[model samples]
Target chain A: MTQEKPTVVLLTADGVPEPADLAEVRDLTDVRVCTAGTLADTLPGAEILLVWDIFSGALSDAWHAADSLRWIHVAAAGVDALLFDELRESDVLVTNARGVFDGPIAEYVLACVLAHDKRLHETEAFQRAGQWRHRETIRVAGRRALVVGTGGIGRATARLLRAVGMDVRGAGRRERDDDEDFGHVVDSADLAAHLREVDHLVMVAPLTEATRGMLGAPELAALPDGAHVINVGRGELVDQDALTAELATGRLSAHLDVVVVEPLPVGDPLWTLEGAHISPHMSGDVEGWRDTLSAQFLTHLRTWLGGDEPAPAVDKGRGYVSG
Target chain B: MTQEKPTVVLLTADGVPEPADLAEVRDLTDVRVCTAGTLADTLPGAEILLVWDIFSGALSDAWHAADSLRWIHVAAAGVDALLFDELRESDVLVTNARGVFDGPIAEYVLACVLAHDKRLHETEAFQRAGQWRHRETIRVAGRRALVVGTGGIGRATARLLRAVGMDVRGAGRRERDDDEDFGHVVDSADLAAHLREVDHLVMVAPLTEATRGMLGAPELAALPDGAHVINVGRGELVDQDALTAELATGRLSAHLDVVVVEPLPVGDPLWTLEGAHISPHMSGDVEGWRDTLSAQFLTHLRTWLGGDEPAPAVDKGRGYVSG
Candidate 1:
């Protein structure tokens, strides 16, 4: 007696996923594609939900319609926005795209650090005005970096920074002395104390209740003058108001890929803030990323269909894939 | 018998070096600092010359006044502009600030490559316009880079690029299968044939008759479309006209720290070229770099005063310090 195929819902941010992207898994499941507005209507009988829209919060709004949902896969490294109390209380399994973003985001963090030290933006401004002004740049090899996450993404960042000769440390739930990537893993509870010595404060922590607004007013003030803040994780991981206020004083510079409110509200001061490098939440979405992400989901889907659990199942209670 | 201290002419581009910067060597020598207009007047009776102004070509014009010159030390890695046929034939020994620039310039090269791959300049433009456009960036890791010139700076660049996971190759006077920093070293004589496969073509070759204009029309035409050209080396190493023509077509992008004309003549086409990133040759001139450069010169000066040869002397005939 064979079991009936599960109905799969592909929730997207805009439009629908390309047929070519889902080709390999098309015949194995009953697929239903929908945007946020249609998600509730399409979720009734679906047992599997593929969150293709990384930034969507529609899952929680349409949770009542998820009558038969047994599993959900986020095509992104962070599930901060999608996590709701009800979903965490449910028996449904959750998994995420973790390994795919590690290297790309690590490279982006390094890029932000190098861009600040080398004054590339100022150089670009000079280029625009046809100016030939020469200025001394800062050396990056010996600078200190504090990566505020100890997960896969943060570990990747620490290793890359160390490889480039930076003095790197990690901040996680607890402290460790002999971590391979970060020589000293500082406890997140003591993050403020460590900021005074950090040259680059990189934020890659998932946005959980315990981690929300981790770098607040006190942490911002703790960083050394002229320290660079790079956030490739969720924007809520930092206190945006405090960050903008500090940036206004020119005491620190920031490279924000994710902001508390993305699309960042056109009227936001950070859009024109001096020393604030703003990019639209795309640190890890490199070319052909969607294809890679879909392929990863397909592999996990295959495992689930074959009566095996996915290797990297997300810890729903913690809101991330815990080691 | 006690010997008289040597008279030293410090050729400067604009103002004199700070007295504090020269305090260590001041009591050991007769120091005469002068700009280009005053170089010839200061050259007479000076047994040693220190080229403090990296971009000055005053030495060639004042060579006839070097009545007793025994040694010349350049406060930079390149000796291209300072090298003249008469000086090469003279009995004077030439030494350069080699090791000091290797690491800094290598960091700058990595910065440029990352800047290009990550679309940093474009991101800055979007921020200025209050635009939050999401675009997919290219990955730097696994990308191929061909570093021209196998000198100290080029070798350091190869190592750093490799450290960041790039597939790096070296272009030098000859080809070799095995190299520590670069797995394969390609003969620069066949540069064009190697261009198609390179994602980034970095020119760090010291300027010499053999290498001058090496990346001319044929070489530029051979590179894969969308390839980035970065020149931290002397501008003459590339044919600026050919480079400009290619840049105008938008088939390639460039980060030029050096151009054929210093200050790049106000109305040069490259100043407004869309894909061109022009910086006033400051790649290796990081903060505190001047102090470091001067300190290095003093150490070499002390070695010479003690009757031992200054180590890492430049091969005046080759226009660089050959291994």
Candidate 2:
């Protein structure tokens, strides 16, 4: 006899299945799709929670109603926004869409690095003004890059940067002399000590209590003059005020995919800063990414349905996927 | 026993040695620096000509005075502008700053490709407007690129693009399956037939009778809609009028570092086109490039003075550095 399908609460941004894969997911499980407004009402007795909206913190607010939430699967690489104290203390297992983002995010980071070195932004601006100003550009090859975070995304970034001949290093929770991706991994706690030699400071670390505001004024100040800071992780991973001040002086540049505030408040200094390059939190969301994320979630859902745990379980205490 | 230093005519844009190396070249040899207007006077008895101004076609006008010319070392890669019927038929040896430009131009092309794929121009535009509009981006890794020329710059471009996981092919003078840089090389004579599948059509071919205006209406029309054309070679390699028309329609985009007109004239439609990215022919002119080029010429000069042939001599008949 076939057992009854477990109910799945899918917290989506628009309360609709965007890609066809999400609809297919509905056929396999008792799926109840809802937006943030209806998340609390839909949470009770659902054995599985799929955080498709990604950055929504609705789950934390509706935690009192999670009567049977045995598993929570976030369709994103970072679990910072979704994790809460109550959920971390709970027995519920958390899994994230990890491998799906590695390649796209790494490619984005490399693109930013190349664009900065080649002065593409200036080229675009000059094109707009009909100016044919010729200028010298820096080479990406042999330049030093320090990737903060030793997770899948950071490792992928390191490999891609190294592939193009950039000298790559990493900063993680612990220091290491031998890392396959980053030849020498420095401790993130001591990030300022190593910033002096970095040409590109790439922040891809997951935002946790330990990593929040990790690149504060001290670390930003420690970076060499004319350094480029690329943040594809989270806005909280950096001190935005400090970065803005540095960029204002034209001593440093930044390619920020995330900001401290979503929709970045009107008249914000970063939007007008000459050295700041802002994108709308899309370092990893390449074309067909929604479909890929949904497919990844389905793979994990299937494994869970077959009486097996998902492959990459997030370390609740650490607040990310731990190797 | 001291040997007499060669009389070198250095055709410069500003008639000054901007880099100190050129000043050093003056001390070592009988160096005569002259601008375009004074080239004819300076060319009379010079045994060696250093075309440091790069794109100046003044040599053709001064050919009547090239009585003692034996070797010409261009400080730039493309020798199309400097090559004349008289020079090609004469015994003058031509060498270029070939290896110096290969890597920098390759890096620039990759930068343009990545910038185009990631919608960096749009991101900059959005930031200027202080709008945080999120958009999906194309992934460069799985995309297909067709690099025209198969010379040093083309080979370097192919390698760099492939390093970022792009599917690369080459369009050269002839078709070959066993080519090292590009596994499969297509003949440029059949360029139109092969362009339909290409996502990025990179033009790095040397400008010759066979290559000038090679990518005309037919080739541009054959490209898939929304395809990007990147030209780091001589602008004559493509039909700019046809490109402008295609770019106007938004059916195709372009990253043009070299234009048919250097300053691109006032009120030129290309400058205002939405899809046209224009740079001032400075793709390969990276930081300290002048020093590198000067050092290369000095090395070649030393080799020639020691009674040895300078390496990688340009095939004057074909108008570029050749195998």
Candidate 3:
């Protein structure tokens, strides 16, 4: 008996959008690509679902009814969305887009931090206006940085920041065995404590019930005055209202690539915060970006076809667990 | 017999407009703080001559006659002005504040690359006017960078660029034994070869007779079209006229900390280069910057006084050497 080409559904509003890359994967022709953004719409027909942009909701009802939906490939680095109580009981396989944007996201964080500290905007304006304003700039070397979340993005960011002579620290849910080598690695509980002392705070933590609103009013308060922030993490990890108020007072300056109300709404107060720079949620997306995402999907698909379990068989309880 | 307290001179027209830090250094109660508008008037009565704003031609005569002048410390990073033939032969000790700016300068290079590629100006304006624009940004990772003059400043820039996954190549006057471990290492002779292939060019070399007008018509033409330049190096290292012409046509964008004419003469056409950014030469001067310069001098002074050679001793022929 021969095995059949697995039925696959490319869910979410945007999934790589590269026809050339996906052409080879058409062996599974019943491939349904609905820009159905919500889990409710995407989970019904998917024997294997490919989710890119995740919303914080459960698709338990759809998963329960679908007899064929056994696998889920998250198109993001974090998998907090599908790790609900409903999916924990099922034998559904889960995978994530791990190494795709590590370099690009790390590059973005560095660009923003350097731009802010060196006062590039002012320097640029001076050039445009033909003025000679020689203001001193803050140096990144010998400074301290605290990166929340220790997944691929956080690790890449830490490495980049450290190479520039920044004292970099990484924090995760639990301490890693080789934590000492990556600077001051801290457990989740110590995030607030670390915030107070860091020169720059970079948030890359995934959004989960436990991690949501992690950098709230109290966390913002703990940070030292003038602490710079670069958030490439999910918007929910930081409280938008709290961040706006904090930035308004000039106590802190932030380069936020993620926001609670993305598209920033119209006339959103976040747009008015002088210290807060909204990047339309684009720190990870770069040229040749779609090609990289599609490549990750192929690797996982090939493994499943070879009768080998995916290396990152998503632990439904922990969402996309990094095993 | 006890040694005399080291004589020190503060050699700028108007800085801090006060001599507070100079008071901290030993001996030389007769501090010659020359506020000479013209270099021709710099006095002849000093044991140590510090040149901050004064020119090389004006001091060339004085340095030849001042037998007691044992050392000349350049307040700036590049010591090309102080590295004349007469001074080189006189056995006068020379030193510069090299490491003081490794981080800030490296930060500047990274900022300009991102600014041009990410379209930061348009983005900032849009965000300020409460408009959200989703313009695509060029990814900095996986690009090639050639950092000329592998001293503290160039090395620092390389480390930062490499952190973000750029293929960082360093060019020193000569190759060292350990050059292989640090990306692609080339000698200054191979600069033209490196420039042709590089996407980003960072010049951190000190001004020398050989290096002056180094990046002239031949060099600029060699660079791939649209290649970006960041010059924290001396202005003469890049031909101002050639660079201005190149920038006017919009093929090149330059971030200049030092220009051929410092404070850039009011009527100079270099001012009009739309792509050229003038920062009033502040890449090395940060707030609390005096302390850093003072501290480095004192640390070296400790070693100089203790019968050990300074770690970053000036190469009399080559100006400031890498530490």
What lDDT is reached at residue B124 by model 2?
A: 89
In model 3, how large is the Cα lDDT of residue A290? 63
Q: Which runs of model 1 end up more than 4 angstroms from their true locations?
A: A19-21, B19-21
Ranking by DockQ: 1, 2, 3
Give the candidates in order of TM-score, highest first.
Answer: 2, 1, 3
Q: Write the per-residue lDDT of candidate 3 for residues A196-279, one digit (tens) a residue.
A: 788788999877777788888988999999898889988888887898899989999898888887678887777867677788
TM-score of chain B of 1: 0.96
Q: How many collisions per candidate?
A: 0, 0, 1
TM-score result, candidate 3: 0.86
> Compared with the true structure, what per-residue lDDT tens digits does model 2 show for residues A171-279?
9998999998898999999889999999999999999999999999999999999999999999999999999999999999999999889878888999898999999
**Candidate order (lDDT):** 1, 2, 3
The value of fnat for model 3 is 0.74
Ranked by DockQ, the better of candidates 1 and 3 is 1
Cα error, residue B250 of model 2, in Å, equals 0.8
Q: Give the local distance difference test score of model 2.
A: 0.91
